[model samples]
Target: MPEPTYRQILYASRSEAGIDVDHILQQSRHNNAVDGITGLLWHDGDHFVQVIEGPESSIAATYARIAIDPRHHDVTILSDRPVGAREFGYWSMERAGKSMQDGAVMLARLERRLTNAPETVRQAFTAATKR
Candidate 1:
């Protein structure tokens, strides 16, 4: 059989001054599951960072929707590329809500399992998610 076509994308954006994390997660989980996407999201008071993985077409379509979302601005794609496997296979959309220090520790553990991700993407993940 041919290898599964998987792609991972990392992006950063400035969240609206008072965006609701719970609401975003709830919507994302539902939308992603319907599209067969899986990923993780991290948001601090000022910024948002997300990594999504799935088929190329679905990733593109989902990102197109995200790029136009009014809740965030100055969105920038940090990395986007094809991968050998899923880095976040289990979660439809896991939100990292711990303090920055604790979030960094959590990301460190997750980094080990994301061997297929580029070093730049991993570095951005750490920087974006940590204080």
Candidate 2:
């Protein structure tokens, strides 16, 4: 059989005030599962940094929707590339909380699992938290 192909897209955005993270997670988890996508999302009150992985077509469609969502602005694509494997294979759309402990754990896990992640992704995480 041919090797499996996966695409990873990392993006950052500014979320509107009063946005509900739980609601977003619930909707995303359902939609992503149906679309065969997996990824992680981190929100720090004002900003969001997400990493999505899946088939090329699915990733493209999902990101296009996100880019136009009225809930966020200043959407920026940090990285988009083909990958040999899924870094976040288990979760459909997990959310990393805004606590220091949560941030540390998420960063460590990403470094360990996706050692080849681009510097832009790391920088996005930092920028999200600092905002």
Q: Number of the top candidate by lDDT?
A: 2
For candidate 1, the 10 contiguous residues with the lowest summed lDDT are 105-114
| Deviation from truth (RMSD, Å), model 2 | 2.8
Q: Rate the local accuracy (lDDT) of all candidates.
A: 0.79, 0.81
Candidate 2 segments whose C-alpha is farther than 4 A from its true place: 100-102, 109-124
Q: For all candidates, what are the clash counts?
A: 0, 0
Per-residue CA lDDT of candidate 1, range 1-131, in tens? 88897988878788888888889899999999998899888787777878889998899999999999999987878767787788778899988745755676556645554467677666665665563
lDDT agreement of model 1 with the native: 0.79
- TM-score of model number 1: 0.81
The TM-score values for the models, in the order shown, are 0.81, 0.84
